[model samples]
Target chain A: MIKRGYWDIDDILADEEPIMVQVTKTIKGAGFLNPESGELDLNEHTRFTIPLWLAENMATRELAKIELPKIFGESYLNILEADPRIISLKDRSNYFFEVATKLNDFLQDGKFITPLQKVFVARFVHLYNEITHNSDPKIIKKLTELERDIYEKGMKTTREFFDWRERKFDIIRSAQHVVNNAKRFKLK
Target chain B: MENEITLPESEFFAENTKITIIPNFKHAGFQILSGFYGPLRPSVAIEVPLWLGVFLKRQQKCRIIPPAWMDLQVLKDKFEEERKKEEFSELDFYYMEVSSLLLAHAKEDIPNHVLICRLIQDLQDLRTSKIRNSLQKITVENLYANFKDIASIELQAIRRLLPATYDSIDYMRKTENND
Candidate 1:
């Protein structure tokens, strides 16, 4: 999901998501990665949890094979498939969709691709219809980071329309950053 | 790709649309960047840009004539057509902006402006539901959607969301595991 060396903060943060992989070949001088065990080298056939970025690299080189996380397992996917609109995806993972996208690439089965599209489309449709009246904080709490970005963008358009309807058009406004920056400079 | 038009920008462009206005002041040609309009005479109705009409109307110097589509009977018939058809009924590209501007600045000038305002709002609500219905059709296998006959101002409402959603969908469908 992340392009290594790209200037994407979200990608960088998403790359930090820990993933599980089984070592096919022992890696030397890497025992420090697993802080729980005081070992000198990573042993062969040991199941290890590593960040997404490293796991992909190791798996591609035949040094390890990735195992789908519990969230990507059949039971969780079945829950997502049953009703996508009501689930609190944020509780499961902040970068749920982003990590899923990356995971789909490793899975040549095209496993996560269909469910990703299905979940996004179903939740997106529900968000579109009811977002204008989304005053309740509970609705936003259910959204993951990607979904939150979409919600905020859609909400901005609705707010602009409502402001225009209320005839608040003639006022000159300050940029959002300017307003926020001003507060920091204020003396206590 | 044509740049996405924002709400205020769309309203600003709609201000350039011409409307008929009856002035109470006599004046020779008033020149503006857009061109020469003018020779204003008392009680004489003449066509002018909506912005100029609203400006003069605010100063109590002229009376604005509501656009033809604002008539109650006309709107009622149009609403009926909108209900019967799956496609959006053709409306003036600037209908949303024009009606909002007229209703805000020259309320007294438009006959039965209250009923006209309500009708316009109801029509907008109907069209919005139609948009939501079409958006549900978007899926990974069938991404191409034919959104035809939508007006400029109405298009502005969903401009940001639609394209951004499509882009996200493209991102999700990334195939090359290499790059």
Candidate 2:
């Protein structure tokens, strides 16, 4: 899970600090293969990096409404068998980031986030996760710079933010600050 | 060398040699004491105006500290020191930082309702403290009042001073022109 600050609703919950949300590279199950024609029926599974935040009120009763039609509605109908809250945050802040659409109201409202903005969000998410989970400061400046870059670029999306995340995580275990913090939080 | 000095060597040397001694002494022993001057060099390096540093760091991704060796304890201490230095600067540079983050990442408008709501709530708490007229007290009211005022005024102005958006292509163009 990726949290950007203390105000995150999960900060108040049980072991919700470094909430784990696997941002894995998806596999499309099948890909086209052909040597002679050099053409096959395969689409690369899209990679996703989702920063799951906190549950708003922490009850399934209201989640059905808060996360329904507006958030994962159509998708909810299909994934309903899996439980909608699994992907949605039933919180008041209206946070939602599904990699495939990375286009929810959050990212599409603006022109587009620059690569720098993408990296910045990734850095901040990692920082917040760390502060929540580990309480480290070494990455604070990086987080601040990342935040500044995003503001300078207007804003970014979940996909753009995550695209930079996997890369930034690989580039700098800076995000590990959050992972480390998560450990500390769990110990407490 | 002593005999030459006794002979008064060159007139130019006689005059300049004495003057150069100060710098030499400084380079030798005095500079060591400078270390006690509060890690000023690192302070200055990190204290560089936020916008300028961010712009450069983004371009030279690997130029800043390699994340692997980043130390949070050190960073926290430094930030604490810097905050102490700027305690009376009339700007919540830090909170503006928070506002900036909300603006940059939220998938929606610049005002960012969630962050704005948070900001407004914080400000309201500060306003309550203002009404009490006891700013010296360490309370959320005082902290928020000062933080909110700083955010609305100084930070707002600074935000306006920066570009509303940046593009890698434009950055490349600027770099190419410099070369």
Candidate 3:
């Protein structure tokens, strides 16, 4: 199967988290007021946690600046450096790409990327290129094996999700097309 | 330089799976992954793999006849039955993908393309409505249960709305807990 570099929107939506941000300008929240929190009353330079979805909106309007948490800081780079497996790298690449694209879209002029985010993005791009272009036979074989393992796991989960035997059979037959495409990859 | 793989559209279907084709010209046979497929003769029906069928169909060399299960009457019946149930009826895992492929790429070959399209749309609308309704009433445990029945394509279609729906549900539950 031909692998394409694309992000799954469903996966992104499912993975959103609350993130801390420093308010750049005092702004009263409109529809986004969390009823439990009463109302969003922000003052310039104050830091607070907001859901990432909401943060995207606020950041776009220049109301706040994202504060990279510990997870997305030096620790992420350490994790990638420790185990640069294709699977893990692919996951990190997807995550960083999604986050970066979202933030870049919203970021105004004069705002700059955090030092850690820049390092993470640079490392991710370097690793992504290495894996995509590597000609080593052993690495290619391992990548192929990992692809097969992912397909099998996906199919198994899909099967367990459905209740009817006939439905399971039908899904397997249809999903075979996807599995076949993934299995037929040729390293360039 | 790293080269990203680009997939041809037909890669969405299982390769080497047999499909019926009606040819319009005479030509020499060719070999493929599974085996060889024929030199063509006009008006003759032959079984060939999905890849060859797609290739021939694209070149306008032959017309592809869809599988038996893809019949308009069968699909209509299934759609009607599924519409009535709170849960979706058992269907081929590839039913959505294959039907879409036929509709998009081989419309002329389907005798009742209009009817087929309408039935599929109605069924999809019903499913989407059911899912939306359930989303409003969801609990954490039931959220996972509801997701199991959603097709990948359906999930893609609804991805934009899901985060907000999930957040509202989570907020409501938390408020209830406090109360």
Number of the top candidate by TM-score? 1
lDDT of 1 by residue, B41-155 (tens): 9988899999999999999999988889889999999999999999899898888899999998899988899999999999988987788778767665676656688877668
What value does DockQ give for candidate 2?
Answer: 0.03
Interface RMSD score of candidate 2: 20.2
Across A27-134, the per-residue lDDT of candidate 3 in tens digits comes to: 766414434445566567777777777787777788888876544455665664455344333333334333433443344311222332333323323322333233
**Candidate 3 lDDT, tens digit per residue, B108-155?**
999989888777667766775665555445434445325556654455
lDDT tens digits, residues A16-122, model 2? 32221221222232222212323342222322222223212211222211122223344433442243212223231222222111222222322222222333233
lDDT of 3: 0.53
**Chain A TM-score compared with the true chain A, each model in order:** 0.89, 0.18, 0.41
Question: For residues A1-188, could you state the per-residue lDDT of candidate 1 as single tens digits?
Answer: 22324788888888889998888888898888776567888888888799999999988999889999888778898999899989999888888878887787666656666787878878887787666455665688998777787787788788888888776876788977898899889953
Please identify which of the two predictions, 1 or 2, would achieve the higher DockQ against the true structure: 1
Better of 1 and 2 by lDDT: 1
C-alpha lDDT of residue B135 in model 3: 47
All candidates in order of TM-score, best leading: 1, 3, 2
lDDT-sorted candidate list, best first: 1, 3, 2
DockQ of 1: 0.44
Give fnat, all candidates. 0.42, 0.00, 0.00
Please give the ranking of all candidate structures by DockQ, highest first, separated by commas: 1, 2, 3
